[model samples]
Target: MPVYKVYLDQVFLGNLVMNYAILWAAAKLSRVPVHTARLVAGAALGAAYALAVFIPGAGFLQSVWFKTVISAGIVAVAFSPVTVRMFLTCLGCFFLASFTLGGLAIGIIFYLNSGRLSSWDGIGKVIEGNFWPGILLGLIALWAAGRGFAALLKKGKFENLFRIPILINSGGKQVRVEALLDTGNQLKDPMTQSPVVVVEYNSLKSLLPEQVQAGLERDGEADIWNILGSLSESSLSSRFSAVPFQSLGRANGMMLGFRPDEVVIERQGKLARPGRVVVGIYRNKLDPEGSYHALLGPNVLELTG
Candidate 1:
């Protein structure tokens, strides 16, 4: 396999400079942090430019308009579906700067070498003549231009957090659950300091018998086995467990119901044990239209080290 070096020449410099400008414009228009926008734009543009120039059949489409369209595609990929006016304005500004400055540099090199205005061959010669120097100049120019544009735009905080999806049993049926892992939810039993998980009462109604549900609604708490008897006469008391929890700034005990199987959480195409978390059934919806069936509390400890 032959490895091709990415040459830093006049053409490369021009492309990089225009790409940086386009990236800065995208960050401003999208209201995203500049570094993130730049990273996305740079990756997109670099790949597209490489494809356009190096792919065997692609070289035939080389033109200013063609390259501009390619650059626009990169911008679109980096920041999907911006307003048409903003897209056009940013693209237009980048195009003008790229063509004018790049064309001027090419023109200067031609004049210095041949001393006369001529044809496209003159521009090509200019590029070939000062290839290495142009690469260095282009990198410096791109950095300076990017910094200048970024200084004028507002900056935002960027956070990268992990999120996991959970599965829970509701009303004797399995339902998919989504929950946020918040380290800030440090509620625990005052006696044990074991983390408290909160759930709405309405969520567990399907699992509870009518009488038990009514009792909870009337008094806000119910004896654990009293409700289980409504579902079965046999001793199901072993299944009805309680995990201590603190809520509303007060320490209390939470009744825990169990499913025969272990709950699994899927993240990034892999499965993991979230913890031996007790399910808390809530009466009201956490978010009425949200997809999550229940929320997992911090009391759940990881099954693995």
Candidate 2:
């Protein structure tokens, strides 16, 4: 048996380029912010994935769990957990790039070898002999292809369209809300200069009395006086304040209101406290099944101010 000498050549260079290209493509597709650190991390991951095959007794590294963990680790280091949308986008891009490159390699190998393409036994031998070279070459090729595809799509526009989840808190309960940051939701209470947080009536019904909920559903405006009279006796009555505002269509209805002890918005791993927010609970459903309880409209000044 003769040992074959493995050498890096133009083919290996081509593969390395491909690997970087794929990583760049993945980053763009996912709309994840890419920097030198992220690129380096992705490249390192690709190399590790390649090394997994050649290291004898490193069988554990070949498992699905190992691969997933490795990939996730790379993503976590590269992307921040700012919003669900961003996270999903990054993961989608990564998997898509990986599959595309792997498929391309398999296709090319099959085409070159024709009907005499190597079986698993022969393939394993080839991999074992030229493990490092193959890993480097394959990653480069995949990365380059991915980058080219990403470039064709244009990175900036794709990222601009990515929406992130909005975090809202009212009273003591916190709800993770998916809200499109609409610049058009400019509804505010003129007197107090407070941003009116709009919420569907049904969303907060769970927090209201059954009778009050039913009355709100049946008699909309007619139930206002009665509801207010009842609220006057409740513990929230002392804390409640009248916020007069006319809806787009509805002529009259008292805006049922509450003063949230505190309100926090989480974005990009940082918490923003927009205090003295007036939460308006409505009687209708904003969306099917009431996906959101309330919308944090605009900020209002505190009574002390």
Candidate 3:
């Protein structure tokens, strides 16, 4: 029975670094937006838990149930997931990332110790050996793998990713169209603060007022603004709004958007009506091959039916 020296500072700092890295990797793998403050808080909580295990009366923290609870808490604090499925996804990714890094660390330790794992002395020798290089290599490999997956979804399998049917109801007219969910299309109406769905002008032209359609068809920005201004006195004034958005080549771009009476989106055999959605009219074609008529935003999917 040998006693080992445990430095509180070393344990806390080591856990803090590992926890933050694991959290960031999970967020990237999950494709969820990361908030720096939230990640820091989550990492600090995890690091504090690691320190608690060393306390004289805190042995309960080492139980399986406690580990599960703390892991869930860390993910919830960091990601702020809106649904059970999202929370589970984040948790799974977190575990995957943790296991990957842990495996890499273990492999490195064994490699440095000439593939011997029979004694605790071999583990202690890891401190004498250079450790960061191997860990940094593992991190880079994980990052590259995540990036490669994203590129596959964006470029390799463009058409199969979350393409769904959408039905727009307005002005006693209904327009059925195909939409490709674009997570990057986070455009929202500045005035009403409603999510904006970018739709091709030709696809949704039937639902727009004749004057509005004609106004949107015009080439000049000034004329488009003038027509929209005059619509203030019209009966359908409240339905129309100006949506500001930024894209790859265009900066400070404005699009004409109108509120639909109802919008129904079909996802995996179920119909969902995202609340307060505004349809932003895009004059150009969304897809060259006519695959999708609209670019759907991921934010709208968060709303309940």
Candidate 4:
């Protein structure tokens, strides 16, 4: 009998690699909702499962069926409300990756040992220097492959993959909100031709002047152009404008617009200013679920560039 010593540190590192691989693969395969914190937690669970092989009474976990169950738990931890089809696909890909890596490691180990299969007997009998090196090399190769796959996906569908965070500055105040990239929002400030970003009135009410806020809160019964005349003589009044738009059941109506002091998109930990965007107050919520309050115009991205 050979004493198989499993180092706890190695087990943790191994689990991290496996977890990242599965997540990277899934991101490449489809447009699935995922977050970094969940993936890290899932990786910790996987490392615990891998370390189970070293426990005296947990030997059964090494069995194929038991390992499959553990892997399922890992997948569930990493993604929320995964469909049956997606779960199966992820599991199959994990297995394929495992087998591929195992084969590659074994082939390299055998080649390094003078191509003599018999010299590298069962693992219990001999401890060769090349054994760990081969495994390390295999791990590195898998990480590189996973990263390459993710890079391609980011290049293709990067914008759709991430939620956009925006800050609207107006009237000496600033409000932050999430926004959806909306190409259909071609409404603009009629006077300056600047692009418009539509937002729910309630979400941005605090930033509006008290007088302006009270006037627009009447369920929009009064015409916006008429309400504009009542604004006080302030910089905020100068910022206000009327935008004409045609929507369902309404042929011609005006939405209240304001030239923001600055409209910025936070990307990659940096604030990118999209020059001179008008914020239009939409009486209705853009997202009933409240995932995002604003519908950002495609022109925002174009102007930022």
Between prediction 2 and prediction 4, the one with superior lDDT is 4
User: TM-score of every model?
Assistant: 0.35, 0.40, 0.65, 0.46
**Candidate 1 TM-score to native:** 0.35
Assess each prediction's global lDDT (C-alpha) against the native: 0.52, 0.55, 0.81, 0.71
The model with the greatest TM-score is 3
Candidate 2 ranges with C-alpha deviation above 4 Å: 1-19, 52-56, 81-84, 118-305
lDDT digits (tens) for residues 1-305 of candidate 3: 77678889977887888888889888877766778899989999999999999989888999999999999999999988445666787899999998998777657656766655566786666634546566666666666776777687656375676798899998788998999877556777898888888998898888887788778776765355766887887889888878887772487888888899988998888889888999988888887778888988777887743
Expressed as tens digits, the lDDT of each residue in 203-230 for candidate 2 is 4554555545665677425355566677
Query: In model 4, which runs have C-alpha deviations exceeding 4 angstroms?
Result: 1-162, 248-250
lDDT of 1 by residue, 73-176 (tens): 76566554444544564556555545644655555455456753367776565677675455445445555655665565312112113245765544456645
In model 1, which regions exceed 4 Å deviation? Answer: 1-163, 169-172, 184-197, 208-211, 217-232, 248-250, 253-260, 274-276, 284-293, 298-301
lDDT comparing candidate 3 with the true structure = 0.81
* lDDT leader: 3
Clash count of each predicted structure: 8, 20, 0, 0
| lDDT for residue 39 in candidate 3, whole number 0-100 | 93
- The full ranking of all candidates by lDDT, starting with the best, is 3, 4, 2, 1
User: How would you encode candidate 4's per-residue C-alpha lDDT over 29-112 as one tens digit per residue?
Assistant: 444446788777777888887777888887788998988888788777876565555566566665677676677666667666
Which wins on lDDT, candidate 1 or candidate 4?
A: 4
lDDT for residue 34 in candidate 2, whole number 0-100: 62
